[model samples]
Target: MSRPRDLYDDYTPSQQMTDAIKAWEDIVEQEKEVRRAAREAIAAELRDARVERDGVEHRVSQEAVARYVPWSEATVLGIAREYKVPGVRQAKKKAADAG
Candidate 1:
């Protein structure tokens, strides 16, 4: 076994190790930023897609009801969904109510 060196005076890292550590840290931070950005972008895209799909589905139901005379939401469940809407978040209370 080798003798223990004085870490306070004799311990010195190679330049390569220092540089490698710095580069590794920079890369890790960059990757984290990219992942954060991608997650936000995906969330926005999903919200838009949901709104688009909801609009189409609502139109289909509206058309189906139009076939009848004096038709109104009162004749059905009347729970219409909103379209192209943003800045809306579902409450946790709704989950409890649903269950």
Candidate 2:
């Protein structure tokens, strides 16, 4: 098989080589920035997903939730709402119901 072209082939370091190196450096820096941004975006999404998962767990028993998996997201959500987790609080009911 033919060898792939090396962008930075061994050559006498000259002004042209220097310029090429600088250009390559810029590309590398730009790629690093792009990777960083993608990582940040993924991290943000993971944080949001974890928060959402916690909210569902808060509403439903954490242990029971595992059994309901493989269900549709909406169905799982419905089940979570239907089966309240113990010890989590909701808004206080009206005093009339407090008797």
Candidate 3:
């Protein structure tokens, strides 16, 4: 079989390439900002998250947060920890109304 000729085999940098690269970089930066905002929002929500169990409310579990967000459980916990969200370091065993 013969190898097909590649269109950019002898490619040279051009102004158009520079503009395209700049556009891609801007988009990547914007995406990063959006992801950061999302993580912050998730962390804040986790801080106030709660669930009722056996007639008592408890802080939401990492698994629950993972299910709500698009990321994995570990990612959710990491974000929660990064933001210093409560219940990330140690879960509360006693009922919310216990004390």
Candidate 4:
């Protein structure tokens, strides 16, 4: 394999090299700032979209829960009765024993 060339082998004058390097560094710094700004803008848009989606999901869940409130309440009451709470009255003896 051919050996890799040394970077400074054909070196230009120090002053010329320093000026060129400074110009390139300035360009790179500006590009980095532009990229950072673009990333922030994208992140803000994503956060707004997520908030909108969450609002829609919350509304849907609330509607569904309202539609089934009576059934849900009945199921909960039945479970409480089976577990012998005083209000349900299905297992008075068990409730008294626990008390």
Per-candidate RMSD, Å: 16.6, 13.7, 6.5, 20.1
> For candidate 2, lDDT tens digit of each residue in 1-99?
999988876656789889999999999999999866654443333233332442553233333343544445454444445443232245466889797
Best by lDDT: 3
The candidate with the higher TM-score, 2 or 3, is: 3
The C-alpha stretches of model 2 lying farther than 4 A from their native spots are 1-12, 50-99
Give each model's clash number: 0, 0, 0, 0
TM-score of candidate 2 on Cα atoms, chains taken together: 0.37
Q: What lDDT tens digits, residue by residue, belong to model 1 across residues 1-99?
A: 999976687678999999999999999999999866654543344344332342442123333333442435432222223323243344345555775
Candidate 3 to native Cα RMSD, angstroms: 6.5
Q: What would you estimate as the lDDT of candidate 4?
A: 0.48
Ranked candidates (TM-score, high to low): 3, 1, 2, 4
Worst 10 residues of 3 by lDDT: 88-97
TM values, all candidates = 0.45, 0.37, 0.69, 0.35
User: Where in model 1 is the C-alpha error above 4 Å?
Assistant: 1-8, 50-99
Residues 22-74 of candidate 3: C-alpha lDDT, one tens digit per residue: 99999999999999999998887888877776896777777777897889999
What is the clash count of model 2?
Answer: 0
In terms of lDDT, model 3 sits at: 0.84
Candidate with best TM-score:
3
How many backbone overlaps does candidate 1 show?
Answer: 0
